[model samples]
Target: MNSRHIYHVDLAPVLGSTFQPTGFPDVGAATFTRFEGGQKVDALLVESVQSMANRLEATAWDSAADRPVDAVAGLPWVRVVRAGSAEFLTSSRLEAHRLASPFVHKATVDGRPMLDVIKEKLGLAKDTPLNRSAMARAVAGLDPFCLVHGVFFSHKEWLGQPKFARASSAVIEAHDVLRAISGGRKSDRVRHQLGEDVGGTAEGYGSVPFHRTEWTAKRIVASFVVDGELLRSYGLPEPVADLLETLALWEIRVLLTGGLRLRTACDLDVVSEVEARRGPALPELDELTGRLRELIGQCGEVFGDGEPLTVEWSSGKKG
Candidate 1:
């Protein structure tokens, strides 16, 4: 069976033709051109790979509870807890580098440095080369999310500089894109102007006007890929591999159904059913949800029997 799964979905604004895309501070919209069927077409990057990775991770988290959502509750992840209390501070799923996050590696767990604990758990010695398969299994037990989205450990102590590439990735782009330029004013009801006495508009004492840039596209598509080949390279057991793949699909389903409101002005809705261009067909949301819970159960041994690994942390613990 083909291991790689590729999905494409058509999208459109929920209310109007114009929709705002992710923008950079100095560089507004990321606009470019590409050839399609021998014709050059204008396109705008609505969401970058890095941004989509974060969004996908967000699908599995419940911000209100500060824990994994119900569908992925039992999956392994690291938690950095308050020094003297069990309260949650941050977790692997929320950290930018997963298990390698500074908040995780720098803290102490039961008087032992978290970094040293991880190295010992992963069977890493100062002078040894990284064993890809062994480390994959070790990481799975620590933080399965890293196996899904990848992580890099650049610490000087880790001479091997181990890293994994994302097994699943997604990006959103608009084709035949056109700019929708508009402007609005931030009204100051209390004070229309302050001149130099109160630092004027720079200090927010006066009405300020700013330009807005949005886009209207002939078509918008969110493309996703799950690399089966990469997953296999990890040498994970059958159950763990299945869980990761299903977890990825589950993430996509949740994002399409409920995470479309990317920004205040960028609300979107799927215009057509998800299309799988390669590998197995996409499963229904309910089916994936049920399967994810079941798979999490089957891989209990891989995820371990302990609560989320906690590292004691405080604001003053300098690296």
Candidate 2:
């Protein structure tokens, strides 16, 4: 009975209506709908592994800080000093909403854009990381994206697209196909959220209409990979390997339990790697969570004092 290494869980999230992913329309992620009972549901188009990483990082930070923070940074405010030189001003707190905030000045340093200067300064290689910053921010109760997701160039892949990235004819075919699909799109309901347009309005500042039709999916399955070998390298305590596997399952359960608009099931059985007994009332979950809480806290410190994020958890009672 060698049941020790389990790393992933498959979750089936049922969407209410169309839910938009963070990616642009060009992605054209594959979708599956209307399944007959027990028809195999493939994990259609996983969000890039990095996306999940960001979610994890963001969750850890948010939990520790007990505040809403974005994983992306906002644009920087710069002022031109010379014809080709600019003085950098303050930028948006990394917590501000944005996908990629490239505040690099048009100015050059050693024939390179100033953005390079920032990248190097932050010790951001291959894009992100800030050690011990999260706990400091958590204590201060201040929110910032870099403190959470770490600073990185999100559009790096698009910039890295090679010359042969798209064949001469493939581009044309893609555009035609995309245009065809982009047209004739309709929605039964449009999601509306209050928004403001300080820059574009007849009045100096006014609210801008915000609307989006969520791209609903019949079910979304998220998979997490466990690094068994890495766990062994740490040479952690009794059945620590098993504990990590169990934690992965709990993390998924907690995320689903978050008030996401869609309905989702933790689908722990899909995670047979740990052999957890599933039920409405599973004290084992709390026990495992508490152990993980202590373990993670001992490591780099767990967000919000060895408890869960966003929502409160103390004395087996969520605050």
**Strongest candidate by lDDT:** 1
Model 1: residues with Cα > 4 Å off, grouped in runs? 317-319
* Residue 5 lDDT in candidate 2: 27
**Which numbered prediction scores highest in TM-score against the true structure?**
1
**Tens digit of lDDT per residue, candidate 2, span 187-264?**
223333224632334432333444333333333444443333433333334343334444444444454344223213
> Which residue pairs does candidate 1 place in steric collision?
none
What local lDDT does model 1 show for residue 219? Answer: 97
TM-score of each: 0.95, 0.35
Instruction: Compose the digit string of candidate 1's lDDT tens values, residues 1-319.
Output: 3589999999999978999999988997888998899999999999999999999999989999998888887887788998899978899899998888888988788888888877776677866777888889988999888988999977866657788899989999999998899999999899865755566776667788899888999999999999877878888898899888888888888899884888899999999989999988888899999998888888978897635887887777344
* Model 2 TM-score relative to the real fold: 0.35
Worst 10-residue lDDT window for candidate 2 reads 166-175
Say what the RMSD of model 2 is.
15.8
TM-score of 1: 0.95
RMSD of each: 1.6, 15.8
